[model samples]
Target: MAGSENSKCRGLRWALIGSVTLNLLVAGVIVGGFVAHDRHPPRPVVGDVSLGAFTEALSPEDRDALRRAAQKRVGDFRDMRQAARTDMTALIAALQADPWNRAEVEQILARHKARTIDRVDIGEALIFERLEEMTPEERRAFAERLLKGAQRFDKRLDRDDNRPPRP
Candidate 1:
């Protein structure tokens, strides 16, 4: 009778241990799947448009100015991003070298603060201006469609920060 009771106690302990181990394994698998999904999600398919056709509607000089401004903005944004990457790399290395590397981190953050990049909503402005030129009924219809698209776009933007601007 004592032997039987001892055996039952050992069996219960083994069952509890097994259950705990299985739970941990399942949790690990779920976490790994989430990380993998985030690392390699499907790329979006972007359609191409003609630059010539896009600029055809504007005056020659205005079109040229717009093109130049767009180029400058893109270049500025790229330079800032490059600088940010460099700063982050240095900060990471510094922190790894000494966990309390506050000075280096602060210096990098200061540079980021000084290099302020302004985001332009040029496309949004252009769309609004063009819509304003249309007749009231036409404008209302265009606005309705635009609102629907903007809502969808906002939702997508919320999910993926790198979505391209619509033409």
Candidate 2:
């Protein structure tokens, strides 16, 4: 009976040790994640949303110039973003109305689309201006990089197309 009790006690002690070790591991992982997150916060997206791949192809100096230009017009972008948010709120309210107003929803969508176009236009203008300032050689290099980026994008799309649809 004593031997059996000793074995049981040993098992309980091992279980306790295992539980503590697992908790320590989890706590360490959580603390490490927090430290890593603090070290590398997410970067804000600047400039045209549609031109992300094209922007990536740009030289660092050209990219900086575009960023500076975008920053100069930050107020305009901010206003547009705020307007978009307001439009979205209105859209949701329209969707939730007791009597569905199709016309109201359509009008809100049209306004949202117009705002999007305006943002794209600003971004395109910035890109065009930067291109004009670049030397012919730089432009050629940029074109090559842009083509490569496009090819990569196409390949990714192809791979995604072949993937099974999610339930």
Candidate 3:
């Protein structure tokens, strides 16, 4: 019957739309996360990937300068990361406590997330300040390196996800 056909067509159309929307959302998250994460050096995680990114584009002296700048603030970053770890530990412990409360967990998570964001903000500020002092050529080269690094990261993620290598 025409009505049956119409129903099937409607169902197919909705399925197609839903699939496309989901794909778009996933792509947006991937792109957004990549850009935000790529803006900084990797976290000091045990399995962190090394981008070796901007150093190839920099003069020895400039690279040294950047290294020194980062070195100077390493302790500060370590402290911030430690604070985040501490907060996470406390959250986990509370989650294990009697009478678990969803509201309390949400509040703790939000505060922990805010602190993490603040740490990133501080890191970005430092990088931006360093870039501001760089020569125009250096800034351009660094941008190129960052783009390449991000692309490499994307490919690695795709491989991990068992997706086809991007064209």
Candidate 4:
């Protein structure tokens, strides 16, 4: 009987130890997540549109300048975004109509495309203005960074192509 009791006590002790260790491990994970999150705050969305790798290659000052310029025209950006959303909703409705209307769908698509082009034009103008402000040397440096970024992108694409298909 004493041996049985001793074994039961050992089992309980082990279970208690395991529970404490598990709780500590969970606590450690939560703390680590918070620390990691604080280490890298989110990047700001410039003009609510990605300018692609060209924007990525810009110098910090130039990027900030461009961001400020975009902000000044925030109203236009907001309107364009709202129009885009409306267009999508309309397109979906048109797609679901009982009697399909190809002309209506095409009209919505054309409007969407025009809005997209307008947004791109605005972004391009902002970029061009920023470039104009830079000295020749600064522009050359920007070009070099742009080229390097493109090369890196191409290498990544090549690597992805060589990867085996996922199971």
> Which digits, one per residue and each the tens of the lDDT, describe model 2 over residues 75-116?
888898678667766866776788967688779768867987
Model 1 segments more than 4 A misplaced: 1-69, 110-117, 120-142, 150-167
Per-residue lDDT of candidate 4, residues 45-145 (tens digit): 44333588888789888878888888888888779767766766676677678896768867876886698799889889988998899999999999999
Q: How would you encode candidate 1's per-residue C-alpha lDDT over 62-158 as one tens digit per residue?
A: 3444544455456665676567667656755765674546577568657756664232344444434544555777556545655666677788878
Residue range 21-129, candidate 3, lDDT tens digits: 5535655675686698968786543222112454454556655655566666677667765665565556666667798655675676677568767766755665566
In model 4, the number of clashes is 0
Each prediction's TM-score against the native?
0.33, 0.64, 0.48, 0.66
Worst 10 residues of 2 by lDDT: 42-51
When sorted by lDDT, best at the front, the candidate numbers are 2, 4, 3, 1
Worst 10 residues of 1 by lDDT: 44-53
TM-score of model 4 relative to the true fold? 0.66
Q: Between 1 and 2, whose TM-score is larger?
A: 2
Per-model tally of clashing residue pairs: 0, 0, 0, 0
